[model samples]
Target: MKMWLPVVLVSLLLGGLPATHATAGTRSCNNNGIVVLHGMPLVTVDHKCVQILCLNGLPMPKLFENANSGCCEFKNTLYAPGQVFLDGCVKMTCEKSKWKPVGNTEFRCKRCEVFNDPHFMSFDRHRFDYHGECTYALTQEQFSRTPNFGIFTEFKKCYAVPSCLHRTIFKDNPKLLIGIGYLGLNAPKIYDILINGEKFTIPGDNYAHRLIVKEEDQDVLVWRQGSCIRILGSNGLTLQQCTNSIDIWAHPDLKNKVNGLCGSPDDNIDNDFTSRGKQVFDVEGFAPQEFAESWLTPPGCPAGRKKGSAKKNFGNDKMK
Candidate 1:
């Protein structure tokens, strides 16, 4: 008998899929390193900006095509609303993990990822991710150098910063789309796609990257990790498929879904530095096991939190 294998795809729509009750936020992220996804710098977060999760101590994928860790690799059962990058998604549930938090969107628990994962989205399609890493402060800098956003120090030296983590790919071929990271914007701007170098923004929304990739290769790394060129191939390269970034769903719901929050990693700016009844790390100090379906957003916002009305005042921008 002859064996027949079908070609896989590497594309994500980033929207319109069943929500996993997945809620991601961070009362504080360390002001240190950076992580690069789809050519964008995911700068180290302040203690009050947002949260990010990664799996460490695991084997790296040999080829870009094999970089898929799946959902089981997330360290500890860190699944919960307001929790950044909840783990253990496979054969997992909000009720079983007691992940869902009160007043939080069900999608927090329901979603695997609006986008692909360096941990959960494995490069080794056949292998399951065993370890993970959540980047903070200086550690994030290992990924890249250039950042769309930047700041000046008291000494007047210029510094780069990470504000968003986004990437895109094509739906048909792996060589078409590419990932682009935006550091800081002069003002709120919308997202659009460029077909053959043509600019095409989403019809109703401008959350972030559109997340377009090949369905068959969706499990692999269609796009590279650091650079944001169209994932499409050129030269001896595929000539135009796309890079891997968002999950297969990132596209279908691209126009309606929230693309996480966007904020400046400016340490000089004022952020919720203290808490009333709780200490600063109390939010991060909570254990996943201690979390329950009922436990939701901490009692109140952190102290010195940026103004809720004028986000830009504190050098913050909440991207919904």
Candidate 2:
């Protein structure tokens, strides 16, 4: 259930509503009655999505953009340039104060509260205790927040990390962990052949329930769904001899779902992915329930303290 959030986000980002393209030098914030904003999704005024005031969901307009000038945003066109907020807090302030960084990159500024919850502003019907949420110590060592868009890279680059790459290639944010591939003994020969733009060769032999690899990106170029995984014999991609479901593709498969306290990213998700790990996907990969209990636990302490292995351990001695 938690894994489905990333799927919802993908659909929103890719399926952003169509808006009029702006002309050179002049960006019509009020483009023919439609409000648009920079770095935000298009929210039609008077749309059912909003309920507070008759003003409707405020559209964050992209004020200016160019190869030279990246992009600038105006907050509802209300506060002018002179007006400022207390650093780290969004409330208005006459003096400059400390500024809080949001997420992994130095993209957007946030209030002390939004600093706690990136997904909190989605504010819709779903609201959680962002201030109380705690990130894994490992993540805190490597990144500021969930290495999300606007924060990392010039834009959102690491968003498409592979399953193996999670907690490995990136900042080891457990929230990004999505189990892929199961070690199946009798699990047939190849259940799914996940890939990006790059094509990989699978060995001809027994079957596999899932395909898992460690990489940094998964910008899918194309997929051959409704096809079966077959032995790469002299015939090349022979579908007739395909024996496994992972090999014999009847249904369309997507990508793994992201799980975390922050808002789900805007991207496509393949529901086939689950958080259950290999037990469900690869029967052979199953371990004793007792062993699985302490799977997420670390053997040592965090990076802050010198030799305080007994100092702090997440999920173990949090309250103490």
Candidate 3:
């Protein structure tokens, strides 16, 4: 009798089938100290901005190249639309096809004894309007240290202080399953999804497609999907895939379809899906139930911690 065991094993290995112990390694990621996906950053696409969700965490990807260059990781995401960096310093929005400055776009210096003091984006409506609705601000003391601080009226300071929270979600499952709701710019056109440097195209009409992957040797990070990029998560609960209602409105027939894959389009800028909400993709279910009950709720980051006092904003006029 011929022993065919060795031959069978060799065939299986050469055939490239999934083995029992997958060699793909895994990594642990703390998104705002909350674990959503194990390795990659949580990126959400919207017409207005391609947000890099947890911009506060450490060991940040070469996204910004030291956070001083005013650049973020993933070119199409952060510096897309207008090719301008939205590092919290410039008050600009992605309009039509370019990064237009909403109000103030220049860095205003604050007189600070040490460039490491805590500063935040000012929210004074009058001041915002005065300063062209800029989101960056600093203390008068900090402003003093600013070069050319108070040198020009165009270079103004903010009165109302703003607040930032490390919005996060914790899940036990290390696997990540993303459901792309829509693609294209004007209409729900077909676009390609870049996963771990590989591109996969899903038809525009099909919103139920999913990019499923667990931590492994396969680098399964979504770089680009259609018109949006540099996508961080949302401040509200629901992660908006498009800039406004138009994207959802464009597809009346696919309303339910889009909702199933990426939540309701109306729930874009607002609404939180922390407790319970529609799955990003209907094909896949929610994260495991083992996630911490408290952690699953809204407000992912801890309270009483300074949110915006990072290395990017502590130096001369550097704010993002």
Candidate 4:
């Protein structure tokens, strides 16, 4: 039998009238101005296929399953669980009580993260660490095709550590370039940003077709959510620069179509160690230091020592 909680709790919250003095033969319940005889069912006005039972001088609501029951409501329409519908380009499913996306909804992008000790998580969810301190391409379109874009990061010795992320650059092919530079160890909260080689202040204006730059508390956010960048397709991209970490995300259109230290997100972790020179390294082998070195920015920049190197002075010389 279908069971339900007593409606007395709900009635109390709605400021229900106090229970009338009960005699042996006059036991009944009044709900929404209707007198319900004991053990009789009353259908509520708001819900379908559910009934309220007057029992013991109180109203108890219960849900019953029928041909029209166990369905979800959306805009006054009922849909069976697991029913799929489309709202524009997005496909949604009614799951018993709520609506959920079916697949590849907006904001469903692949993520690549660079965090403490400069560890890396690729777009395909492969995790690795590369401690080389040099500017490197974090991710970019395959073969640097036109309408291409690239996210790069420069690692430097900071707080005496050999490799710490100190700068991030997002280049949208031929024209737009955004650079985010972190202040030195003593004053890490301050940031120096540059747009197309000119100094850019915080809370900057949104570039219509490119990206929006905003400062939130201590971190700076650069994103293209609704605005479509050709390389990222519709879902767009987002980059968050925190104190010592950088987080990046690219739309699903970039899957299997990108190459860098972030790897090609083809859903296969085996080839995630592909080097800048198009060489694939064995995932089970030793750390691919050469793969990391090949992505060094400027084509000929010197590589920084691994994590075990002697601590440096962390002065202006190390910031480059």
The digit string of per-residue lDDT tens for model 3 on 40-90 reads: 334422222323332223222223232222222232244434354344332
Give residue 276's error in model 2 in angstroms.
Answer: 15
lDDT tens digits by residue: candidate 1, 207-226: 11123343211211122212
Best by lDDT: 4
The residue-by-residue lDDT of candidate 2 on 237-273, one tens digit each, is 1111111111111101101222222112223222111
Candidate lDDT scores, in order, read 0.20, 0.20, 0.24, 0.53
Ranking by lDDT: 4, 3, 2, 1
TM per candidate:
0.18, 0.16, 0.18, 0.51
Best by TM-score: 4
Whichever of 1 and 4 has more lDDT, that candidate is 4
Model 2 lDDT at residue 126: 23
How much does candidate 2 score in TM-score?
0.16
Q: Model 4, which residues run further than 4 Å from truth?
A: 1-107, 144-147, 182-192, 204-235, 299-320
Candidate 1: global Cα-lDDT? 0.20
Model 4 lDDT per residue over 212-246, tens place: 33321111123222221111212244565666666
- Sorting all predicted structures by TM-score, with the top scorer first, yields 4, 3, 1, 2
Better of 1 and 2 by TM-score: 1
